[model samples]
Target: MRRIITTIDIGTTAISTIVAERQKDGGIRILGVAQGPTFGMRRGSVVDIDEVTVSLKKTIQEASKASGMNIKKAVVGVGGTHINTYNTKGVVAISRADGEIAEEDVRRVIQAAENSIPKNPNREIIHIIPREYKIDNESGIKDPVGMTGIRLEVDAMIVDGSKSALRSIIKCVEGAGVEIDDFIFSSLASAEAVLSRRQKELGVMLLDIGGGTSNYSVWEEGRLVQAGVFPVGGTHITHDIAVGLQVHIDTAEKIKLEYGHAIPELFSKKDVIKLADFGLNGDDVYLKRHIAEIVEARFKDIFELASKELKRIDRFGLLPAGVVLIGGASHIPGIEEIAKKELRLPIEVGKKVNLPQPTDKNLQELLFTYPVALGLVAWQVNQLSGDNRYFYNPTFESVSSKIKNWFKVFIP
Candidate 1:
């Protein structure tokens, strides 16, 4: 029996792994968590399989040892610039003679929704999540099972990616001695970790800022309205800092973590950083405000891009619950203030909490880094037990087998 859930997020900047157990209660107990730098991936897609395999093996071994659990199979989180999403609707005549909708009817409508999208040889369906459903004159039904309806209709968000890219990720994970159990969109997994039902219902945006690209999702009325990835991320910021300061990438990353701020005015002109302080040269110094300016410009562009994406979906700055920032880039100081100024909405950092008793010190500190992993754990727990209460929306079926069922729907 599989009682524990293991998750690995293949990110652009880092590979995050976590081993957690679902308690008798609804909460999760973090047994072990670990992260490793991405040696072979860029923008969340595999580039060098060998390097990624070695790095993933090390991270998995570390987490397994910490938890004293033998890790065999793992749920994988996927995100990249290759990811693309669009919305389409499908309708089907209810098959039951009594006109009472059943689970099979719901499934058929979802499959119809997917079939409406033409197949692309170069791309594959990564996720086909049902967003809304309609029955004849009735609309907005979430779960239509047991409901009376004549014509069943569904609107779904289709997420697809480069087929070659996905195959490479599967190969790398398997090469590391762990079998891939399932695949979930990394941003959606992060939503499971940080978003509450009320937040989704009241309208909220989730921004998962990673290393090479940032993944964002908009939720309103308890359904996903939009999902997109920005090509710029923390790595771009570090690159800008390195170029502006004429320093090494490592040095720029260190400075960004130490003194990075989205609001340059928050720092005084007199507050200076000496090169020697960070194991660099002697006596040379740079004004903190100047460094802040470099960091601020890059993030401003990210938020501005986010504003445009929101406007495309007509949810621009209108989410009542506002935007929740997660992932590695969210650690930057004063980032929320910059987001607020650029987007004209309330900005907040996603909460890292609600873990079971005996919380590991590492989990408490690095929970921010493992949002997607935590979400994978939550998702698996719900899948095994059919616990739809975890998330208000009912889209878990598509997390793994939804695509397979798409073709099965055509069979007589």
Candidate 2:
């Protein structure tokens, strides 16, 4: 039987679905992709299950029809203000007659780290990525499966989300008649799609600016150090434009996309455009520079908020790989230059590069707004190739087996 994977990205602005097949030579072939306007979501969290389910069903049906495959299971991306992340460490004695670390021992240590998370009724752990391992007195070890050690320890990053929010997302997907393979953090998924291995190793930050939220993640020494979601996003810029120019939201959105720039200095003050060009039904003309000022203000706020997060983690302006911007808002003219100036770091707009072959030109355009969805499928492919027991197949044989596999993380 041929192996196929599908992924759904439920974002604030749109729902994206992609289906791909794993080739015999370990390459991925894009079979189909679809996207539609998302509803009942704000800042990446589902507010209405019925509306989200309807949108999801349509998205999945479109992709399935295009790919000529039934969409039964998929990995989903989740993000929003409800998401929380932090670091923790766990230690345990190797349980063996000869003091040798084994695969079970690794699992135990990770379990120990998981146990350290505070049990809160409102919160649930979604991801536990092992950052590094220490065996006996040795530290900074990536793998110690066959090594002899009396003491085994691990440091990991645990991603948690609001229990109610998670349940809402799960219920919506299940209602759409699709079973979820797993839930991945939205920013982490975007990072998987756009970031190079070398950038992660050299310390980098990824900012995915969507419609209602800007999700971010920092990586250092080949491991995720921090991840978060900010409520401000491209929609805020549009709102600012609407209020400043006294135009409808739809008209403001069109203007922002057609003429917006993140740095006001790059635009000419003398260049005036009529509001009627954007169907605003007004005779007044506005200078491009004034419009850019509004965009620059919002962009500044987003970058400064991200800078505060880096400061809190003591990694501000320290990352050699600097900042990589992705998602819908990343297309704003001069956004990268503004981000570099605001954060005092190197900046680049991120693009998808890990796909082995993508035949559809439309797929390339969707990749910008659908990185999280594409990353979800890419993540599953990596897991299967690496022989991940938890996600080896789409369905589990029993409840016990499912429980055992459910909590596994992407860290190796």
Candidate 3:
């Protein structure tokens, strides 16, 4: 029997599920995928338990029908402005009698790091990533296992979220009769889909623009360096267009997708969009420039915030791989150009690469918007089987293993 893995991406605008089989060749064969309008989630946090539960059931059922398999567990993606990271350090005395480091000693040191998390009744640690290790006062050690040292120290990054918000998501998933195998940050999952090894090594920023929010992750030297979420997203642009054009939300969204351009200069004055059918019975016909102006304004603001974040991290000058844009909002016309201009960095639209060429029109349409969901599936399989042939590792895997072993004792 083929081992199956499922991943759910609960976003501000939609909830998606993907079930795939782990093939012997280390590639994932997508068995089924399902999506529904999201509820109970805003800017990546669960807000309504009942609504989230109902949405999860709908998507899971759809995926089950297509895959012909029952999914009992899943890897879920989480994001929101409520999510934050802190830098922490920990030290421990080595217990090895001969003063030689062993696996158990390494495990203990990592546990010490995790145990040092400050107690916050409102927040819970979601992930702990060790940035570096020190052996016996000697710093810059990446892997301390098997190294002789009397003391062990570690620098780590702790990702935490509002406990109530996280519990709500977990309760909804469990209420749907499935366990969560793991939870990854939303931007980290998106980074798995679009970033190449070279980009991570040279430093890269990934921005996933969903319906209600935009999520970001920065990678450098083959490790996740930072992650954050912005409360604004593609939905804001639609709202702007709606208000600017004096049209309904649905009509505004349709116009934004069909005629929206982030750069006005790229569009010609001769270009026109028909608004008569849209019930805009006005003497002034809708011009492409108007739509571009509305989209550009919102998009510029989003990119400006992203730039400010980079500046705060002192990473503004270091992203040689520039910015990679993905998710539902990335489909807007001229987005790549707008991002390049506003962020002053090289920009590219993230496209799904590892799929069979669609032989039908319907499949092609589905492929375009579901890259994040598909990428989530890819990440799930990779984590379960330990195969990441596509990317390079800048950090020692031993560190991840040590952290995972320690976490299992508490989180499971």
What C-alpha lDDT do the candidate models reach, one value each? 0.81, 0.82, 0.76
**TM-score of predicted model 2?**
0.91
Residue-pair clash count for candidate 2:
0
Off by over 4 Å in 3: 98-100, 136-141, 268-270, 277-284, 352-368, 386-412
> What value does the lDDT take at residue 320 in candidate 1?
92
lDDT of 1 at 365: 63
- Lowest lDDT block of 10, candidate 2: 390-399
Q: Supply the global lDDT for candidate 3.
A: 0.76
What is the per-residue lDDT of model 3 for residues 38-114, given as tens digits with 9 covering 90 to 100?
A: 88877788888999999999999999999898989888888888888777777888887888888677567666776
Q: lDDT winner among the candidates?
A: 2
**Could you tell which candidate, 1 or 2, scores higher by lDDT?**
2
In the range 182-215, model 2's lDDT, one tens digit per residue, is 7878888787677878998999999999999999
> Model 1: per-residue lDDT, tens digit, 136-226?
9988877788889789998888887776777777778878888777777788877876788788999999998889999998898988888
Tell me each candidate's RMSD, in Å, in order: 4.0, 4.7, 5.5
Give the CA lDDT, 0 to 100, for residue 215 in model 2.
Answer: 95
Q: List the residue pairs that clash in candidate 3.
A: none
